[model samples]
Target: MATKPEGTQATRETEAELARFFARYEPAIMKLGQALRAKLRQRLAGLFEIVYLYERQGSLVLTYSPTERGFEGLCSLALEADGVKLHFGRGAELAKADPGKLLQGRGKTVRHVELRSVADYERPEIEALLVAALQLGNVRPEAGAKGATILKAEEQKQRAARRPTAARTTAARTTAARGAKKAKKARS
Candidate 1:
């Protein structure tokens, strides 16, 4: 029977490599995740992408970006084994960090982040994922059909619907207050 994959990156045939990586690092790696989180303290917010850096049994460890703030995802990578994991920064921070640029200029351990723009996504490396998102409508829909007009119309309709009820409520409250005042005057 085919087994579930270990934590290594998967393009297609790397499943076996993943299994090997898991076999090499499994139980110890889980503890590594705990250690990483402890190091980050609670900065482990959930805003950024989490990345795991891998080396040969702690040879060259590097983290690029993580989805969760702090080291949450990084710890997950550590816990999983398939490879080494250390917490990187948030996704935006990672991108802005220009690990690739740093590596290029200074021969940093991290190197060459793959920058995929809307145009660059047409490349083979990303085409499949792009197609999947397209299928899922993850990208914005076309103009006109789901454009700003629809949103503006909905907002206008909501405002128009609210106005009459708000006016009626205000009028009712005023009338009730006036009636109460008249009764008090009569009593006086």
Candidate 2:
């Protein structure tokens, strides 16, 4: 993938948002995720990227599509705490294309291959799967069109605040009562 010009505001924001997303995972997983994403960008140069950061689930997903909707994605990269997965959106259609049964998942629509490193993406079988997926999506990479990224959603895990103990609550009330008494006395 060509390096995006650093001066562009959109590019800077996208990089920063992605950086924050990667910060949630372990170093090794984060590194693998970055490498996998770079390889995907290189392989699918002109496809629009729709990103979803589900921090509550500890997963970050990037879907490459001909259009903006993720449901229209040709393929997706799912980065979780454990590792990364390359998901073929139309895996059911590509089952015959993958005679080796490399793709996992029994769902009717999607199937994925667990990716350990960037090199896994370069494997012949995976490359073939990608090409087949593109064809299935009926998308051809537009010449000289480096796709833009759209951050669809970010769901950060919400931490509940600790409730005050009964003793603390009582003490607080007592303090407030004493202050009120002192104020009344002063006014009198």
Candidate 3:
């Protein structure tokens, strides 16, 4: 029997895993994820190499690193809880000079900006922050590194997940009731 090559099987598994992960989010979130991904890839093009890592906690991270295996990351785009965030690995240290005060978190070395809308990507301060972070990390584009790269893609064992919060559930129910009422009135 001819066995399929290992790389082919791995690629298929990764695709399926990504598909499954994406299916769990709302359409709006998926659209936002696509936009953020494109924006970041464009902004960092020809710079650090991009790597997508899917976590067991149901978060997808796009990490930018100088070397394939080296010290901490320069920056990363994370998709979580129906939103996208841009994380600066050494954010805490940069907080002192952050005029925009957009970076959040109290971690020793990490800071992040939660992007509520696509417009966040256009803020001048964001680009400034990214540049500062790259400089701080001492990251320089490789001689011929011109684009993003996917170094690893995989999913972990599934676990029981929590349901949406009560407020969201109530809002959904109210919307459905209003929709049903509108349909009945139209029929009358």
Candidate 4:
């Protein structure tokens, strides 16, 4: 049998991780997220590195950066329950020329637009905004850079607390402990 190419295992693992992450969402939401990711990859093909980030807020974010592990991201696609959002990292810098007023945010730098459908990706104004943000961020893909890389997954402590399964587990443990103490008293 032909040996697998180097890094193939890692790639498969990343894909599996991403799939598992997406599986947490509803089917409709997952479909929208996948479409949004595909559109972004197609638009920025060969021009930037797509970094997958499992954020602390339970978001699976795809960040476009000039370099792998870069300090700043040019833009990002955040998967959400209703749909996906495109976030411009240097939105504050582009606000002055934002004729469309499509970006929504009051923060110092970041701005975002909710993309509810695939048609949103084809808008000229959105394309312009993305290009502007990329320019302002000074993001240029390095030679021989891979098209995408999935960063190591991050697990948030807050998420565990909010999980129903975790709550059930805690309740079960407490009940078991109480039952054990009652049985010991009866034996005594």
Question: What's the number of clashes in each of the models?
Answer: 8, 0, 0, 0
Quote model 4's TM-score: 0.69
**TM-score, structure 1 vs. true:** 0.21
- Expressed as tens digits, the lDDT of each residue in 1-188 for candidate 2 is 22234358878887897888888889988999888888888788888888887755878998998877788999999989889999988998999899778999999999999999878878899988998998887778866568878776532222212234656789999999999999999999
Q: What is the TM-score of each candidate against the true structure?
A: 0.21, 0.77, 0.64, 0.69
| Candidate 1 residue-wise lDDT, 1-188, digit = tens | 11122242432333333334334444555345334433333222221222222342342222212321223223222333343333222223333333233212123222222322223323443333323323332233332221100012233346777989999999999999999999999999
Q: Which candidate would rank higher by TM-score, 1 or 4?
A: 4
Clashing pairs in 1: 48-66, 48-67, 48-68, 49-66, 49-67, 50-66, 50-67, 51-66
Model 3, residue 161: C-alpha shift (Å): 18
Q: Select the stronger candidate by lDDT from 1 and 4.
A: 4
| Best prediction by TM-score | 2
Superposed model 3: Cα runs more than 4 Å off = 1-20, 47-55, 141-145, 155-188
In candidate 4, how many clashes are counted? 0
Please list the Cα RMSD from the true structure of every candidate, rounded to 1 decimal place. Answer: 22.9, 10.5, 13.8, 8.5
**Of candidates 4 and 3, the better by TM-score:** 4
Q: What is candidate 3's lDDT per residue for 1-188, written digit by digit as tens?
A: 11112357654654465556555667777678777766765666554434454555667776777655313677887777668888888999878657999999988888999887788877888878887887787765544335534444421222213234666789999999999999999999
Question: Which window of 10 residues has the lowest lDDT sum in candidate 1?
Answer: 144-153
Q: What is the lDDT of residue 50 in candidate 2?
A: 82
Tell me which residue pairs clash in candidate 2.
Answer: none
